[model samples]
Target chain A: AQSVAQPEDQVNVAEGNPLTVKCTYSVSGNPYLFWYVQYPNRGLQFLLKYITGDNLVKGSYGFEAEFNKSQTSFHLKKPSALVSDSALYFCAVRDIRYTGGFKTIFGAGTRLFVKA
Target chain B: GAGVSQSPSNKVTEKGKDVELRCDPISGHTALYWYRQSLGQGLEFLIYFQGNSAPDKSGLPSDRFSAERTGGSVSTLTIQRTQQEDSAVYLCASSLPGSYGYTFGSGTRLTVV
Candidate 1:
């Protein structure tokens, strides 16, 4: 089974300061990791994904994530946070072997609060 | 190009009532998915449509929950005997074949009173 873990229930950061939302996963095969953000009353918006490339992957809205195989983690990072960036974050993992079958499993989700 | 679109942005119904939510995928997208987001469950996959075939229905919580996609474009999710626990945001997403990024719809908010 492919599963994702977001250790933090919520994260608070000051605007203009760097922010980090932690995520980890467990899978039977190679992992296809993804990050998505959801605003109130809206569907989730895709941020970035890590297939099989560089360790660091950049995404929309000045966000990025680092894929660490040894740690089994893919934490979302942003150098500078904005108040508007406050939203719910989810980490997802899809096993390569089940690419055509099973759906991607998402983490419980982490609420990010960027305060001014 | 338009993004995924879902109908009945918000629906309120009494217990035992049935509701139907519709989704229109992008013009060329071959993959469509339905997911439910609740306060306790977060986001849970309900069903997925690849072209006109749905190979996985394991995500549906119960027999009351059913979905179908027709002509490989439009999809409908029907919930029978609506329960208060079913109150949540139902989202739809579509993507191209072998594409990793998914385009999501605004989502329909279903409130079972």
Candidate 2:
């Protein structure tokens, strides 16, 4: 089974400070990790993904994530936070073994609040 | 369409009624997916359609839920005898073959009263 875990239910950060939303995963084979953001009443927007690439993957809205195979983690990061960065962040994973036929499992989600 | 499109931005229905949610995936995309999201919860996979292959219906929660895709383009999800528990945002997504990411629709908010 492929699963993702976002440890924090909510994260608060001051504007201009770096922010990190933690995510960990479990998979039987190589994992395809992804990050998505959802605003109120809107669908989730893809941020970035870690396929088979460099350890760091940059995404939309100045966001990026580091894929650590040893730690089984793909934590979303931003060098500086803005008030508008507040939203719900989801971590998802898809296993390469094709056990469930392209079903991507998502984490419970983490709410980020960037205080001005 | 440039992105995945879903119909009936919002729907309110009485309990026991059947509701249909529609989705139009982007042109040329071969993989389509349906997912349900409850308030403040993660997405629950509903079904997946890839090209002409038989869909993977393992994620459908119950017999009351069903879906179909026509010409491998437009898709509809039907929920019969709707209950309050069925109320949630139904999201549709699609991707090109072998694409790692999905383009999602705004989603249909179904409220069963």
Reference interface contacts recovered per candidate: 0.47, 0.53
Q: Candidate 2 on A1-116: residue-level lDDT in tens?
A: 78999999999999999999999999887789999999877888999999887999999999999999999999999999999999999999975645334567789999999999
Lowest lDDT 10-residue stretch of candidate 2 chain B:
B95-104
Predicted structure 2: clash tally: 0
Q: Name the docking class for model 1.
A: medium
- Residue A94 shift from truth in candidate 2, angstroms: 1.1
Q: Global CA lDDT of candidate 2, please?
A: 0.92
Query: For model 1 chain A, where is the 10-residue window of minimal lDDT?
Result: A94-103
Residue B95 C-alpha lDDT in model 2: 85
Q: Which segments of model 1 are wrong by more than 4 Å?
A: none
How well is each residue in A43-63 modelled by candidate 1, as lDDT tens digits?
789999999989999999999
- List the pairs of residues colliding in candidate 1: none
Relative to the unseen true structure, what is the C-alpha lDDT of residue B46 in candidate 2, on a scale of 0 to 100? 92
